[model samples]
Target: MHVATADQHTADWLMRFGLVRSEEHLNHYRRQGFAWMVARMFPNAGLEELCAFTDLNTLLFLLDDYLDHQESSASPENRDKKVKAMIDGFIRVLRQPKYGEQSGNPVFVALAELWQRMKKMSSRSWQRDFIQSIVAIFTAAIWQHENVKAGKWPLLADYMEQRQYLGAANIATDTIAVVDKIRLPRKMYEHPLLQELTALCRNTVCWANDLFSLSKEIAHGDYHNLVVLLSHEENISMEEAIVRACEIHDDQVKQFMRLCRYLPNEGPVMKMELHRYVEGLKNIMRANIDWSDYETSRYQYEYEEHVRTHKVREHYLMEAAV
Candidate 1:
């Protein structure tokens, strides 16, 4: 299962970009084990590609923190306005042909640098796909926030459909080409079986995340996870919901295997690229599991002290939620 050798390359790259301004932020980043997760997800990645991958992951983590904590705490009247502005600003930065200094937001600035680097490093279509995937994520977060505030959780079908963006797996898949320097033919990439394979990979990763973060989400009064949604919508107990969530993840894995048996036929070069992409997805799913299992900081109550505990009881570290 140790698909990749561990390295501190990405952790070191954090400072090179000067993304974290304060000692507090710096300490938080170090504690996150973000770089290691990226490396695991992209087992064969070179230093430069791994660093870029980790940077995007870290940037998204910061944005999610802002949404779930800071943006959520704002008054309802201000929350919607602020979230939209931030989303729009980020979208503009990502969609732009070149980096611009319009937004003072640190995340936006970091993203612009990333966009430039990705533009030069990846194909034009890959760049477009990445932007679209990220934009969907931001937009979906905003919608989810509004739905929760309105006390209206979506139906299971709708939720599953929209969760694609929340998981941000499209961007993760797109990274294979840039990081591995291999490109699958567009037709093979778009084939239905390949799409199903990708959906299974994305679902497994997101569902596992739902299980891992269930307690934290509950304690924060956030109930957007599949586990929470299932329990609430189905009128089932939390224990039952967790079991159901695991079943969904397992079933997806089974389907992933079935789909992998019949991947699209393509030229040798394209077949190799497709194989690499599939392997990349498998590694990403495994990385999510590894990260949640080992890196307790994100879910741990006493992250600084390392109690090796879990869950989101009120007595837990309220400060860690942000």
Candidate 2:
């Protein structure tokens, strides 16, 4: 099965990252340590490249915020610190003038403008909409660029003429279709020609979903209770929860690896590798907890202790209760 292979690949990758030493370790890492590791491990590529394409740092930061808020007894000050740290990192990356010693990446230019606009938006809904719009635009541009690079000028022209109609539709879905439809002159996926770019696209989609989920959690202030809620919803034991979390983390890592195979020679290989490192860091968080030792009734104490030590703050406790 595709899922089984993906799961096995993920597990092996996690082991290499030292993220699955034990169930207890997994829990601790997931609850408290993951965010810090992710923050430290994010890719060092310029902001322009990241914004133009899908990069992992933004998503990791979003997840870090989610975990910080979900821990019981998370403090207001701690939450603010995490948010500030994330924002500072974003600004640091974005302020850099030179990205990859290249020029005339229109997608990068568009993304810069979108990021600037997003930085100015105060409304959460508007910000989400803007991000979605930017992603759609970027996807379209990438597809067009791919066609041009492949020497499919006729198709490129066709796409340009239909751009307005296509732009009004869902970009991610449309781009996927475009990728499927394109007739490569040769078997491209295995050619080692566009491996990095392919991987970037795959990683970008996964990262985008991760970001979307984290943003939803933060906007609703439901971070602290997410794990407990997931356990309850699945009607699984704490041990089972740990197992599932490890499994999910592993799958994500494998997907990243698969994406790496699609990169072009000039693409950001280091950047993608750094993204994998962040994945390893997240696995560390998942590996630190011994979920099997705790009874359902003991969730509160374990969670509270985790939160207190982690300096979590400003979660929507009452809202999450519902």
Candidate 3:
């Protein structure tokens, strides 16, 4: 997480303004590097704008953490019902698209505030797209909860499809447009190339996440991950599953590079817009690894150390061959 002088000035103000009641909660959220990532994504943003961007990510991360895993004493059935209600609350915001903070939940208040800024900054169509992308995340998170309850591992394709939304890549990139003032015309936005670009970034970032978070998820016995899903589908050990996951990341990245070469060469302004969008995608890819590697405590250095160990990989491959 690269912290600019501008970003450094804004960090304390953003934290104080956006944090909920708990001191511990605020500390945890800051530790996740949400503000740092926002500073990178919207490098040109002034203090207020950067704070707003960071607030959305902070709320989203906290919401995800609160909802995804089992932390409460509620029964499985009750937990599912609770998850449904939380997801439905966000879905209602999309369907109705309200302003003014009436909800008691600070998360909803934060989202409402974010939505207000978004509506002011971007087109209605973009807003719709952003909301829909966010809704996809909520829905997929419900799927995660349901999967945990049912004790069923989805196939690799299905898992990837869901985790793409979980990565929130679309929301992240589109928000970049608003914060950075990248005025990509609808034609460019709708182009197959751009869609491919977005999807590839989404896939790669999420799968990199799957790699970085593998040990954490494994320790929790969570199968809502690319590596674990592949392992199940291929009957491979964790190491081999990791090797396969790396292949997925490599393939997507190569496709992204290939597609970058073919991005339409047009007017100077349009080309620059396309270039900015591509750079935003790259920021996402790099930020995920940077945050995972050093910025966040959720993933352990020991996990990465294990990934680098040839013995584990070789042992798994040898066993699989036999």
Candidate 4:
């Protein structure tokens, strides 16, 4: 739960790139304290590691919001195209870490910087894995958009399967190795126990997020949430859905605890790395809950007021066009 001193510096860097435009935008970004969350998740990161990871997390928060807003507002035909372009841009920069240097898009520029820094310290195998996790996130985003456009409500099982990637939990977990420069043996990294633990960690954080952010998503006309889906699928009240969601989240936490208590012996160094990695995952779960409950104003936003303002802007634009 320790916060990095470099959190403000990361926010300032984002502001410099014109990401935080108005006072409202700045307030929105700062209130979430995304960098603070990053710091907690990687509590042992060195100053340089902390700064780089914080920058990545902060930029991602903005990118996720941008994609969600665009997908929700744009015509179905045009929506996928924009998200696909973003995915391609990310892949291109990942393939050639310097490719973003020539681009004018701020997203690409920031991504390239992150890629360059990450590539310097991480092995090629690690980089490839990280890229795969990121691509999975984009793919899941497109899937969510498709579901929304089709007015589809995914079954609870299906949503849980894809939610791990969509929540970007894999990407955040992968950073455990990157920030600490701890590379586990290939076999150890791929062990079933480790894989299960990772999934448990992802589910715990994401479901808790689904619970905390349910109100905000409902206000935004977004149903790609566990509580909403649970409510729809079970034909239950929102209160009942929330209780069910919490039960599921608690189950995951219990499993994570059970797995942590029985980790196999992978020799001393490998065992230590495994412990640290899982600990980082635990930290992320804790940080998410703490930040969502106390540090963020995101879920407390005046949704109706925002909708009214948006309508006013639309009408003003229509009048000007006429």
Candidate 5:
């Protein structure tokens, strides 16, 4: 299925950018089956769009992992410098893709190529939206780093507000139009209803992830999770925090569903595109939960051994066939 297609493609893509250096690294990256999630989130995507989405998703996950590692291990001053460098390099590539082609950093070079590819597939407006989301991601990283440096957990409200951007859900959702080949007018896309729906979608995805990753984050003493933040801020038990976080996530899901009922009946084309976009958001929420439950080993330890074994067998089989 989608995993089979994206495995080779993503491995090659990551290796080309020097992001992955070994069979073990490729196995670890592929074990998450991000392409499977992307395929689920954008069910309407054709082959090309699916591949592009897979690469984009993989790149985002890589960046998040690298930064998260830096958050824990690197000194505050060192991490800040590294993060700033990344933000600057990425901004440069965003402005001019060719600028990073000659750079030594694989991430910069990779992003330059990926940005160029994305530009060819999206409208100018869509490109702008995607870039804004990316900048939000960089901003969120700085926000999180500052909180960590200060050794304080943000209040629940503040964490929720910024957590959506940290999750990159906006970038994922923004691609619906590209996948569907429907360019929404800026006015329609920015309508209050749609904007609210987008917020709900982002919150739902990010909070659900917090729920799934609670144990791991707690073990790592990472305070960037909603559940952890709520527990610490409210002086509540972990169980109480979990229950409250679930309540918040369920509320957002319900709100998203309720608002979809009132989608504007613009022109036929606009209406249809809006519905398609809404469906993609629904798919994203659904896929996030489903993937966390069934596919991702990051949250599910039982699945890790299963995934590792399966990947090893698949690798050997492919080698044997060759």
Candidate 6:
């Protein structure tokens, strides 16, 4: 959300395009344009709905500022070219004949495609933010679908958000099969054909976990104690622990696949797959000393001490205020 002084050339172009009538209008246009792009790309969901579903109101606000900065700072010619490219891509998707047939599902498919295109146009930080945001959206969709299927609408308001509910339901009902078939803890992760797929999934999950951890930290103004306990016992940095987790996930998948090739393809493949993966996971757990009782207990104690100190500080502050 940093801004640079506008160069004369860029300022002239903005004047010509009438993009910035004044500094006050910059944020307004940026939000409007971004909202337009989102709506045009994902016609099924409004700005508020998308923000709610992804829980990304903060990020969207940041992105609005970012776009305004880019518009003000970047060269006029470059800005025009980039805008044209975005418009052209949008038009191409919209004007395509037999869109529904080509995409199978127009709403999600088109938005996913447009997201990838826009991601390329954004800065590196923005690209990462976009990926994280999409992952959040996808996760929310999955959660909603499961809630509906369970027939226990925990909150009636969740069900009222039709696009998110339906979109999540569709992904869960359709895409879950493909994901489930991949068989975690199976040897599939090690297989040449499936290695890339497994790696992609592990990376995606890790990214999601990182974001989840960040949110937890921000909410509590403190790091999660469980993670601290794990890190201390593992004798590794948090980043290293995350990497190891990803590695372990990939390894478990590979081992599972190796086990699968041995099993007879007679009865339930999923049942057999789980059995093999669980056996491999047991082996992995045994190999990691951090998973042992003594070290884990020590770390847990340390984490509790850390949390207790924070609680004591808060108690003293409240007493002083009173």
Choose the strongest candidate by lDDT.
Answer: 5
lDDT agreement with native, every candidate: 0.71, 0.34, 0.70, 0.76, 0.78, 0.34
Better of 1 and 4 by lDDT: 4
- In candidate 4 the C-alpha lDDT for residue 15 amounts to 72
Model 6's lDDT to the true fold?
A: 0.34
- Candidates, ranked, TM-score: 5, 4, 1, 3, 2, 6
Residue-level lDDT of model 4, residues 37-146, one tens digit each, is 77767778777777778777777778889888776677866877887787788778888767777877778877787678777778889888988888888888878878
Q: Per-residue CA lDDT of candidate 5, range 65-126, in tens? A: 88888887767788889988988888788877888898888998988887887888888877
lDDT of 5 at 310: 39
Estimate the lDDT of model 5: 0.78
How well does candidate 1 score on lDDT at residue 152?
84
Q: Residue 268 deviation, candidate 6, in Å?
A: 36
Question: Residue 93's C-alpha lDDT in candidate 1?
Answer: 86
Q: Assess every candidate by TM-score.
A: 0.85, 0.25, 0.85, 0.88, 0.90, 0.21
Off by over 4 Å in 1: 1-21, 97-99, 301-322
On a 0 to 1 TM-score scale, where does candidate 4 land against the true structure? Answer: 0.88
Using TM-score as the yardstick, the better of models 2 and 4 is: 4
Task: Predict model 2's lDDT versus the native.
Answer: 0.34
The true-versus-predicted C-alpha distance at residue 35 of model 1, in Å, is 0.4
Best by TM-score: 5
Superposed on all Cα atoms, model 4 deviates from the true structure by an RMSD in Å of 10.7
Q: In candidate 3, which residue ranges exceed 4 Å CA deviation?
A: 1-21, 70-72, 94-100, 304-322
